[model samples]
Target: MMQSTTGELSLSWSQVAARRLVRHGLDTPAQGARPAEIVRALCGAHAQVVSAAFWSIGLRSASLTSTAVKDALWSEHSLIKTFGPRGTVHLLAAQDLPLWAGALSALPPSHNGQSQEVRLTPEQTDEVVKVIAAALSDTELTIDELSEAVIAATGSWAGELVMPAFNGMWPRWRMALAQAGICGALCFGPNRGSKVTYTNPRRFLPEFAPVEERRALTWLLKSYLSAYGPATPQHFAQWLNAPRSWAKELFNALSAELEPVKVNGSLAWVVAGDSTFPSSLPQSVRLLPYFDAYAVGGQPRELLFPGRATQRALTPSGQAGNYQVLLVDGIVAGVWHQRRSGRRLDITVEAFEQLSATQRRELDEQVERIGAFLNAQPCLTLGPVNVGAHA
Candidate 1:
């Protein structure tokens, strides 16, 4: 076992990776885990690709299936679909909305690379948020329905086609959708015949209110450290898509509660109580779907994406999770893809190196687990996954 010297903990990259896998519930599935519990542990599951998000959560949970995740969202009201860290669609625990919403609300407003004409002024943004809350309160509406409500409530300018979206321009008020989510005015509802619907977040947890900003940010920082710790402020900033300077300042303010550590001889930190790691190094193989939190949140990109993984699993610009990833012992080893048809699922993996016999058995078991989660017959094919990014 590696030992720590006085006054600081020195850890190898393998140790850090192992700790992360354990925290993420990837090393071993948690028995009979609740969907909300799993989502809470990982902070949130990226849900831009809804199937990938379901698989991401189901893979880490022993008995919970994809239906359970949906139940948590629509039936039990235990999980919420919202704009989360990096302003991406995510399924966060409903109980945690106060903290997540408050921390996200504290972020400096992002322009989303929009020009002044495409963006709303601060005052206009505020007005839009107010209108969205009023429109969505105790009711669900499709984008068109909500847009009509917003335009009727505001003015003709709010409905002007300007902001570019897929194949066409979105209405001017659409720019404030994410901002409304951050302000606790919006969340996703069950689809209305393939059309997505939005409703007030308060519909889930009535009496919901954002926590105070400083307390919420502190809670968020510690939560990130607990899940992906021994990391630097820069890692935190990248994960949250917050300003680097702001992240650095927040870390400095909370320095007293952070324990400095040496990860592969580089400086990093963990929450004071979370510096210890398990003795066992991770040996489990995990097939993570696109935008999996473990794939997206792992820090020190080079260490997590060693060798060919950097080329195979990551995007050209160094973003993780654009492609499905094969993880060997908590590090990206290659790429994988799944094609589902009817009740059958075909999985193809492109590993960088040949796997040992035992690892192959584990891989098979992982495939079976996914099949059970999706209620499909599973088949695994080992070969080159000839797919483009985000395929």
Candidate 2:
């Protein structure tokens, strides 16, 4: 469907959320969408905390077990965890890593523009990337081992390279390592103890071919729109950690493939041909994990939440970051956190509004499913936290 500048398809916020639930595979069981399909569908699952991504998949897929998620990453090589959009660790489809990496690598590192912040020297950055690429050529190394390798490779300079971050000194070599993760040279491996190990993506993707910048960005945006469509330029840029101007420029450049749509009376663009959703779709309840793309991807929180909903879910810094959201009828109706003790799991759900009996029943079933995915016996608690309701 095409919409002129003056004429656009109008959609209610509820309609958009319903479409997203369907698109993200939460509305119906996408039986075939394993970790790879599920992550790719959401433009990669936000995985700053890896366990969250595991649950993100289980919530979307009917049969994905905790072991299945790990197997897909380390054994089956179907998924790869790497730094994706916004320079955050995301679990992405291994087959699509090259394109994702190419597009992300094209964007300048977010730290470079930190004006008053002392950053890594360009020479030091280059040396660190080279060392990581060489040391991890066929081997996986935890951050400590990689730090040792960088120190050994670059001598004293590596040790002296440190930057101010989180009110403490962080190894400047980490910047290059992060950049390499964005550029596709490195990805996560199984954790050794409590430390994450890194290895070259070439271990499974030896046939990786470089993608042109525009082509890769185009591919990524289209996929993003497919899953998180009817999104504004600001939403795309914010999701990618790039400036809004870049998003606007890309939209203008790719206008032919774009279609305008109205989002709860506001304007947005979706890839052409996907601008419509059935007027009536399924109402669903889900437990979306921390940073699950579906909860964090789409925007204009005022529409996604009831009054003061964003205030209830935001961090201390006032960002609408999803830590484990409760989705009722595709809107963020509650928030949750989990604790695992051996084979026992405890989940606490903080509902913004009192759930109806039907919704409560669904919540119970969902919690049980989450426990099953983790191979644990689960106990549930539900209540409104102080911030859950502003009234």
Query: Which has the greatest TM-score?
Result: 1
Candidate 1: tens digits of C-alpha lDDT, residues 216-264: 9999999999999988999999998888999999999999899888888
Give candidate 1's TM-score.
0.98
User: lDDT of each structure?
Assistant: 0.91, 0.80
- Candidate 1 local distance difference test against the native: 0.91
Could you give candidate 2's per-residue lDDT for residues 212-291 as a string of tens digits?
A: 88899889889989988888888988888788988899899999999988876688988998776857757778987767
Q: List where candidate 2 sits over 4 angstroms from the true fold.
A: 1-5, 112-117, 121-124, 165-168, 385-391
